[model samples]
Target: MDIGEGARPGLRERKKRETRIALSWAAIRLTVERGFDNVRVEDIAAEAGVSPRTFNNYFASKGEAVAARQLERARAIADELRARPASEPLWEAITNATMARFALGQDDHRGAEDERWAEGLRLMVGEPALQGEFMKTSAAVEAEFAAVIAERTGTDADTDLYPRLVASAVGSAMRVAIQHWLRAEAPGTMADLLRDAFAQLANGLPTP
Candidate 1:
């Protein structure tokens, strides 16, 4: 039997991915329900139906587990950006890539999972204990974005300032947009906010 190049994961890999997803959601839910400091690794493990050791194998701390979804989304965004056609302008590619990963259109409807993730992210951001872990995850993902930027620009990530600068600016714009969305009473979809944010970047933030 010839396994195709794009074959699905084996049983072990599938089980591992399930466990990680379970733990990630469990951690987010527990941290939001019971304050971050109060949600222990064991609590997350129990919620996910896994052992504490399994939790440890997947994540270092409750904070890391809680931030897993954000990390996953960041990676997905990078992957989408990387796959965009080379002829597209960089900023347009970034904006479209973000929208694609989010599955967002002008009249997009959010599901329960999307609402839960938004609330969980808001709560995590407000928790001081999780800030460190969140920043670490953000930094790691920023590096990934920088690498992709370098690839597209044909520059060395370590030596080129342009890629790093663009990555930082874009990342900061997204973070600010998210924080603003979380604070708004009638915030629109994340996709819209992100599009507006990247639009500002593409326009060089000309005076309003």
Candidate 2:
């Protein structure tokens, strides 16, 4: 569907997004209730109220389905960063966009639900098959951010590697910040932790 430039998401695109979200949540719920290994692709499709073929159309594999939500969220962050004003620093823009998208909310599922999703993510980290898919998605996000940064800095994304490098570094730092917050039993709020993390990045890290 048309989603770029002046194009708006059409009815089909909106339906696809809803279906994808439903499938992703269903897969996570099933995996949380039963071990990831115990849940079959067909079972997840059924849980999501879609046929197995429809599930494949949305996600290539079960693991991908499980990770769909995070990947979609990351893509949204990239889009937001690309739309930020050119006068803003690349890092600041990206950090703001990322935090705005993922920052904790009062109604957000950060208790048992979050823990379950985190466990699923932890499992994917060790799964060899899913590693490639994860890397591809992460690289796509980096490229999107890099292109935006390149434009703002008046440099070509191809010749200048700084934008790409910075994007990767920032993405890694954000991932680490989230992991740390999660490990801390997700105490306080995601917004607070994210603000602290992004503030450090925006202010520049001090050398030892």
In terms of lDDT, which candidate is strongest? Answer: 1
Give the Cα lDDT of each candidate: 0.81, 0.72
Per-residue C-alpha lDDT of model 1 across residues 69-135, encoded as one tens digit per residue: 7677778889998999999999999998888977833222342336665676577788888788878
What's the residue-level lDDT of 193 in candidate 1? 87
Question: How big is the positional error of residue 122 in model 2, measured in Å on the Cα after superposition?
Answer: 4.7
Cα RMSD (Å) per model?
3.6, 4.2
What are the runs in model 2 whose C-alpha is more than 4 Å off?
1-9, 103-109, 112-129, 185-187
Model 2 TM-score?
0.79
